[model samples]
Target chain A: MKVTESDDVISFAGGLPNPISFPIEALKASANHAITENGSRLFQYSSTQGYAPLREYIAAKYQRVHGLDIHADDVFITTGSQQALELLGKVLIDKGDGIVIEEPGYLGAIQAFTLSEPTFYGVTLENDGLNLEELEHALQQPNVKFVYTVPNFQNPTGLTYSKEKRQQICEIMAKYDDVALIEDDPYGELRFQGEPLPYIGAGKLENSILLGSFSKTVTPGMRLGFIITKNKELMQHIETAKQATDLHTNIFSQYVIYDYLANNDYMEHVQKIIALYKNQADAMLNAMEEFFPAHVDYTRPEGGMFIWATMNNGASAVDVFHKAMDQNVAFVPGDPFYTSKTGVNTMRLNYTNATPEVIREGIKRLGSIL
Target chain B: MKVTESDDVISFAGGLPNPISFPIEALKASANHAITENGSRLFQYSSTQGYAPLREYIAAKYQRVHGLDIHADDVFITTGSQQALELLGKVLIDKGDGIVIEEPGYLGAIQAFTLSEPTFYGVTLENDGLNLEELEHALQQPNVKFVYTVPNFQNPTGLTYSKEKRQQICEIMAKYDDVALIEDDPYGELRFQGEPLPYIGAGKLENSILLGSFSKTVTPGMRLGFIITKNKELMQHIETAKQATDLHTNIFSQYVIYDYLANNDYMEHVQKIIALYKNQADAMLNAMEEFFPAHVDYTRPEGGMFIWATMNNGASAVDVFHKAMDQNVAFVPGDPFYTSKTGVNTMRLNYTNATPEVIREGIKRLGSIL
Candidate 1:
């Protein structure tokens, strides 16, 4: 059976967090409170501007945690980070405009920007972040509209940019008069190793849009996230685009999340998730180190979901994927993540959802197939 | 203060249902069931196609209620009818494409379609529906793309097409080989004063897309809606557009609505809303008859939220709106709904949200101002 056939399949394809990790009791309590206390407000057609308390909460969190001085007005709550990408794509990209993306980026971002039919330019990724030279080359393209980057613990790549590299990229972006930067930081808060680096939008880059989400930290299915931009004109355009898209994000979700944030130890909950994922990551890495061929290369991530593995001597990741699936072990082949011509030898493994035993067994099975 | 400043003002401007009529207890019970029975599924990322049971339920409802043979696979669940409109606009309307709309159509539709920057042609609406001559003239324009209409109880006009007119419009559309039709029927289920008429898409035409929603019937904040299209290729395009837009609609909302449909009586609830709105509509009509100037004219709506009122001797609706606001009564002016150069000396009054007493008193106050 194909991956889409059954829910019982030990699938690694979905970018979903462990269901066991959801704060179900907290969510239930919030739901009851929302319906009983603020039922009318919850059911009414709310302002296109999102729930005020939620926006203020997010803005304050961003300022305190990331040292980013964002105001509530600068934040636009979205259905998900997915909708934020779509709205930004709509407002920023004209026909044939160039969108610079990392060679291996999030597939959802690719899908969102594709609707606008913008030309894609792939920036090569290094250990620290996006390759600065390749990024400069892409930005030099005459119609380049914006560069999209997942700076901290990126999907598929599992790499975070160092502080120096982030500042360099920001300087390069500041030098460009026309191009804007979309810094997507959905996985930023999950860091388990080293000091947290500043976001690409942190310091002096004025022409930047930052996307943050509670999906990884809280729950993905709530479909709650937000976009922040310091530039008023760009924010206005995105706000209009949002109104034309879904009228507004789900107000009930906004209120529920706000209530949860207001009444709970959110940081403690996030720390628990981090500990769980960190242990899983370690198990997967240890299994790979023990079982995999010496020539097989992979990145050891500090935090976040994925580990990108590249097979040596041009061994095909697709072949291994098919063989491993027969043993009920599956991983996403890395070719889909890349916009370039070369992507046959790489695949992505996610450690967030599987148990330690499953990770060990699955990696061993994958190694046997390889 | 402006009408937008306070919720306490007598509002006929918002497209909202009566707050008193919401199935709050039922919804709360459904939500509790959803969280308890399927908490993991509710908190996990779901299929982009939507929750299967919800789609199946909607499809069966369409077949049973409207006599349309729709399958679950043919349905694409959306955030709301608003998102459905936005998705259709994204997939179908390329830049500079010609889209025909009724002269006084829904403002949300206009806003949703405007993002594509499509050239719009207005088909003048008569007592029955769209004027055939004007529609034919608009369709004669080279490369006319599609015609959008609300066949049952339109937004501002609250006019239902006669059965003969429906056939005529579909036949005309069939003749134009390249033209498509979008039948947006958000208010179709709320009929209280008229016999049921066949939907324009129910016939032999294979090029029509129909939109339906639970917003008006169930609750708007749930933001549950779906689109039905027989054109498979176009449906695939729309699915892709939906993935790009918001991944999928809220899984919890979908599950809650599905459980509610499964456990409770849907038609009985709809009947209650209809009875409430019907009384409110009658009160507004009665007040208009008693207090409005002799030369003022308005539609006697058979169903839905609105009654289109044209002022005496071509008086500006905006001026009347200002005067009414001064008297603490508010409504949407009609000019924004039109696609043509000519202004409509009209206003749209929604009777759904206000109590019968409030409607009568508000209309009397506006009448004195006029």
Candidate 2:
């Protein structure tokens, strides 16, 4: 049952980025530089909005890469993207307020939103994106506060929205003035295959909100993430909420990370991580294609950490999980991903935390069980 | 109104710990040591509870200092003590639930609790501690969830509860099974003049919770704080809430702080901070004594960051705030400290962020206005 504890276990259960992907020596130097340069001000209480230089860097990155009109004021730092979910819950959601989420959604989002006790309207996810009809239906609900989407390399499923679907979503959401669009893009920068797609609502939609995280690409242990939006009213409320939650995210981490980004080539560092994860994703996909039974269907992810698999032969994933544990292999059963009680026949496999060889071995074991 | 931004302004408004008190060099060494020793694990995702050694150190400190029966399992790390308040609100509070607070409460607590939309019952603070009668009245409410107190050197007030009052509070709270007792003790270790008093409910009551922070003694920029409780049920709920909030506190900061504590003389460092704060407090108090009008009453604090001043002649603090600004001085108006709309004649002066000469100048200017 606790195969994760065993030294020989090949676990794909974690959502962790590989530690090898972290630029440790560079970060250590950055930490030292930030401490030496900033002096005691780095250790003192700072503005609730966050460190100005870090926010400026984030704004500059988005402006340069996306050609979006994002400014430093548009970005607000958070403890993590997980906290962005919680703060949004605090700021926007009321009890029984309608929240539109992808069916078999990100569990962390679900967990954060659940604290507000919102009425979840989960739309079905298609191969390319969310089901358009279901998205429209969920949006049409009178109390719907926001439509939450992970447009690129989505968690658990590791699926990206098609360009056509992204445009349609923007067009449809533009009609609803009361509703906000939350496009979470933690894995957007990790795209290793195919052309990068533009965000669905970031610039096009008036009420669009974007969530970004350094957890996957840089470091998760620092727990630095941010919310970017042009909506001043909503941002103001979140600032207040952020102040109450933790005053601000860790300023020491903020300074250290800002120094790291400033001194080193950030994109070059990210490219190394992209290459590493690309190899892992390829190994897992190839292993599944070779060894998995025909009745067991799985996603071939382009980027990000996870692969979603469904047993079309009606094999219960819970039973398979037990058998896999017996063989010293582990993965997450996908039931917890859904807002509703579904995904019983599905499971989520993570490729980023393990090596290519370990991922292949783990998938081979799972394929035998299937 | 913007005197705070001016260089010549003597600001007594900030609740920041003095930068001079921070052990920057020692902490820099600790940061380097932690990153070098732990490798990339320090940058990866960690336990929701916290870094184990840090929690263990915290637990052992309480066991050794207070003779409280605490273990590593009893301590849960948070982003900051501010987040502890937020987590408590999430776990223990419901809309319309009864919350007992001080009359001039910690504004951060007020902000955090306000998110849950709880019905706050403010028990008046006497010279020694909370008014026993008012506390009893609040706890007797049917929906009372918790009683929040800053028992040692409270924020804005800088008052410590007497040993007798502590005993009485424990006795009174022991009757309320449903109400949890939250004794936030951030400044407990910073006692410079008085004999340290025992905690009211940490060892005496079943549902007692103690909130501690490194923000005051070590560094606020790192945003590390924790909750220590023997109540497993409440702790489990807080753990879930913490995981949903930010995954965990910054592990890099946690590891570095733990490393610092392990390698350095922590209590010796704390003593230095205590001594620095004591001198600042004495300087402000002495200035106030010499300059303030006879009609104005203010507390002579033995320890902690602030001194509460009340206009006995019924002068409006807001009006005084404007005049003080005209003279390029700043102090916090006390209206926000109350849960209710009161405290118009009171103001909170902070001593830790300014020099003695500056504090004297500020008090002189404020006194002329008074």
Candidate 3:
């Protein structure tokens, strides 16, 4: 019996944050306050650069956290970090321009860059970070415009770059003056344990572009994300692209989000989400340990939404996925995550969207299938 | 002293809707209700196609209004109609691909299409519509992907197509089997006096793509706009482009907007807006008639945001703008509106943002400069 998109299925397919962690009450209050305080301004078309107060707040927060000399003008808000990817492609990529990505990368970035008709070079993503030798080789290629990475708690793999590796990678890329390092850190704040890793290239490299989003920490539905860079000329080009794309990000959402940040303890709210995800990750990891066959391997993620499982016994993930669906369980096959489409025996399990018990049940079913 | 960015300037330079017309209280109520009813679902990442209910409502409304058969799947919501333009460009345009646009077009559309690096063919927009012969000639050119038009009260020009011209243009366009017709009607609902015109190509042509927006009637800040089309293959390609551009439009805004429409009398609210714009439109035209020099010819717009003024005396609008700025008055010099940048003697004056008295005063100051 094949179960497809049933309510009874314990699914780990969605790359969504736990909705239970969303600050609903605070957001509701913020929405009302934003409307009341700003009035018509909240409903009016704002600048292409984004809402002023929100941009300033983002700049200040980054400065405080990273101890970087970041300015408000450097923080450019987007519809989501997804849009930042699209806009970056518009700015940087011409037909057949070289773009470097991790072997198994965030598919969203892959999809966004594909529209620009770039030749993608996939550098292998090791346990700590990118394989530096491979990255340098890719960077050495002609017209290599940028290297995209989700360094901290990366999507699908749930991997973070080690501090030493981060430093080493930045040094390796420092030779490539024209190349940009895009450090997309959507899951940086959701660290369940360990010290937060510094971005590899941001402060050191002139062409470093950092992306952050409120999707994981605050809410995804509002679609508020931003790009931070000190490169004025690059930012100006991006601003022009952004204007052409959608005029600007939604102004009302910007005001409401800024208001929510102003009124609430944002870190406190993020802490609650971290706690929830930590529990779910533990449950899934423990379930895999208890039930999976000896040949199967999976990452024990410290933070972030996904735990990547690799079938070591020459079993295809797509086949396993079909069998798992028969047992009322689901997960994303890992093929889509690969630019080269060679992750045939791997699957990505999202731990954030499900409760601990439900995650355990889903993993048990998948383990039985395997 | 020149007025550069002072609050005292009585400006007719903004292409913004009257904030007085924004259903603020209803929106606030709907926002609250949408949150309370939907809970976490409203805050989660939604479908790439957009919220299903809102799409359905839009399709139903178009079907009712236009007497056309439109399914819910035909309507795809965007961040703004601006995004629709961008997405259309992304799907249709390759480097040096032929694209047809108005001679004096909406700057936003021009900006959006420019990113795709298309070879723009600007057909002359006559008093009623595009010159049929010019349009036919342009469409005959190789690889002409689409002809874009704002048929009802066009941006920068404030001119609507005559009924006969609408049909004639469609008939001429019918000769080109591969070319699409994009009928952008952001201001169709804002008709203060004249009868609402039928879309030239929509429902009549297989490749007709209609763009609409809530920005003019509802609120621009929410950034809600949509593309309606009967062409499944074209829409699917656009959906792919849209997914790459931004994962989705703000889902919270979509739910809030849908809820607002569901709970409130949307047409009644629109009627109030129409009435308000009518007053503002009349005020600006009356002021223009009373104050403008004989050599300055301007469109007496029946509806929509702008009044296009042309200087028959060969004085640059930019020069006039500079002089008007010294008098603490402003309007957009129309050079940016043209693809070839030849609207030197034309200016676009927006009446919607300013009050009637301010409009009168600004026009009087502009008249003195003339």
Candidate 4:
């Protein structure tokens, strides 16, 4: 059941960015420059906070992109956004501490935080974002450390929170001083059709932490990300915790990325990626509309990698997964994404890894299977 | 306090392997080859365990170098040995779990395990290794999870356990069903003068876990290390834990290291490092004997980066460190290495990063300051 599908199989399983999207030659040159220019510093122990220039670049980007007041020191570079989740778990969560998450949340975040042994309370998600009423209830719970969400282009589900909801979240969070918000914005730059929404955490910096990653826009293999916050004390705890985690993220990767940023325009590269993903997403959605029965419905994503579908008809996603496999198509069953057990007929399909041709073909096959 | 003491300062603070010790050209070539051959695979998300070939190579090295019957499946590549320490803390430690470390242990390990809030049992470090009586007692203590040690040319101390002691440790560990032994062997390959002692954990198998790294032997910047254990269940747990840590160690670094190992004779490079380090060690020892006051004492290390020094006179190491810094000669105070903060006049010196002439001058200045 875990077998890699054959070459003929049209797989919509991986949320991978297009392989051709990378400017390989530029990256290679940057690596070469890092080795030549930095000399031993590239290979030696570096500051646990991370390379200053890279941190500065990220800081500047955040200010420019989101209108946030992120200083260079406010950023602590991480191995990945996944690690940011783990570090938050390590620094903030104690055994049986209350952690608020969205229903059908990001699985990676769930996996990252579970080791801290927090008791999870999930807020139900609506079409626009997390249900505000449920989220307020979760936040008010005793010992709730933080409420974590991916505000833009969230994983598994392709929903982005509305601007009004973002403001209401900030106002709601201010009511509970003990509760913190974690707004993870990994795919914030990938919006294809809609105007970008203000990050809820961005407006409430004092009570929130922002996580950013280069995995989607750049190369995931470099494994670069950051935790951005206004809280210096929290950053210090994470920096110290990071020392124990891996001393720091790979200095070599840090140098290479710094050089790449200095020499090339990565935002331009991100734009190209956005264009490619938008086309693939359109193809997948169109195919589903044309071929899928009315009983099956999916989220019409404005941007990002995934399409979350729910079957109105009585069909188990697990059973459909096996049937799809037999038809040489694949997707992630969405039950595992929930902090609580639900979403039995739900599935998440990736539209980013494949081309328009492949995505259309895969969605057509999946539609027939459904 | 964090100043990198000027170019004029002959510092002995870092346990850094000489940058010149690495074959930079070979490493670059390997990086090129990895990108050219693997393409998207090098830049894509990889297995949580590691790149399979890299794990296989490490498993093979254990068999060839240490005669440990390690299977590829037994290995899990980490960001570095530091992360290995952190991962061990995550998987094996709970609040108040008993952790046995040396009195003056690796500071990185201390910082890593402290977050787990373990009850530490620090065994006295004899000239040869961990004091056997203390180790045996600690292993028998209730709720002891593991006895962690750097058995060969240990960090900050430069001590290697004897073969007889290794056998004794294995015997003692076997008696405790609940306790495990962790043999951290980052400096094992750099043994310059003494006969290679058997790894206690290697022989103990089921009751032990061994950590190996390319950081000291190759380059720390690439940040590659592995945990080898006969217990597959423990390895599986570590793999899952690692996913939340950083997804996996950088795939590009893994590919480059693998290619370099396949193409180059790294053992020959390590031998060269041993030869250079041994001469520098001799120079540092000789200078101490000639210039240091009679009240001061230091270790005569055979291999690896550090020599442990103790001032018998009631001078504070912190004071000595500041004075030495003013004199443009630097060394690390050994206070931080202690698990329970007893060492106040001990210091750790490194001889590998500088030439013999530099080592002699640095020691002379440090001795005068003391």
Question: Which candidate leads the pack in TM-score?
Answer: 2
Q: Give the least accurate 10-residue stretch of model 2 chain A, judged by summed lDDT.
A: A1-10
lDDT of 2 by residue, B1-370 (tens): 2458678888988888999989999999999998889999899988999999999999999999999999999999999899999999989998999999998889999999999999999998877999999988888887999999999888878888999999998999889866889999888888888799899999989999999999999999999999999999988998889989888989999999999899999889999998888888899889989999999888877788889999989788888888899998898898988888754999999999888888888898888989
Clash counts for all predictions: 0, 0, 0, 0
What range of 10 consecutive residues in model 1 chain B has the weakest lDDT sum?
B1-10
**Could you tell me which 10 consecutive residues in candidate 2 chain B have the lowest summed lDDT?**
B1-10
Clashing pairs in 1: none
lDDT of 1 by residue, A103-186 (tens): 888889999998888999998888998899998899999799899999988988899988889989998888885788888999
Interface RMSD of each: 1.0, 0.6, 0.6, 1.2
Quote each prediction's TM-score: 0.97, 0.99, 0.98, 0.97
lDDT of each: 0.85, 0.90, 0.90, 0.86
Off by over 4 Å in 3: A1-4, B1-5
Whichever of 2 and 4 has more lDDT, that candidate is 2
Off by more than 4 A, model 1: A1-9
Off-target runs (Cα >4 Å) in candidate 2 are: A1-3, B1-3
Best by the DockQ measure? 2
A358 Cα displacement, candidate 4 (Å): 2.9
Using DockQ as the measure, what is the rank order of every candidate, best first?
2, 3, 1, 4
- A231: Cα error in model 1, Å: 1.6
TM-score of chain A of each: 0.97, 0.98, 0.98, 0.97
Report the error of model 3 at residue B327, Å. Answer: 1.8
Q: Model 1, DockQ value?
A: 0.78
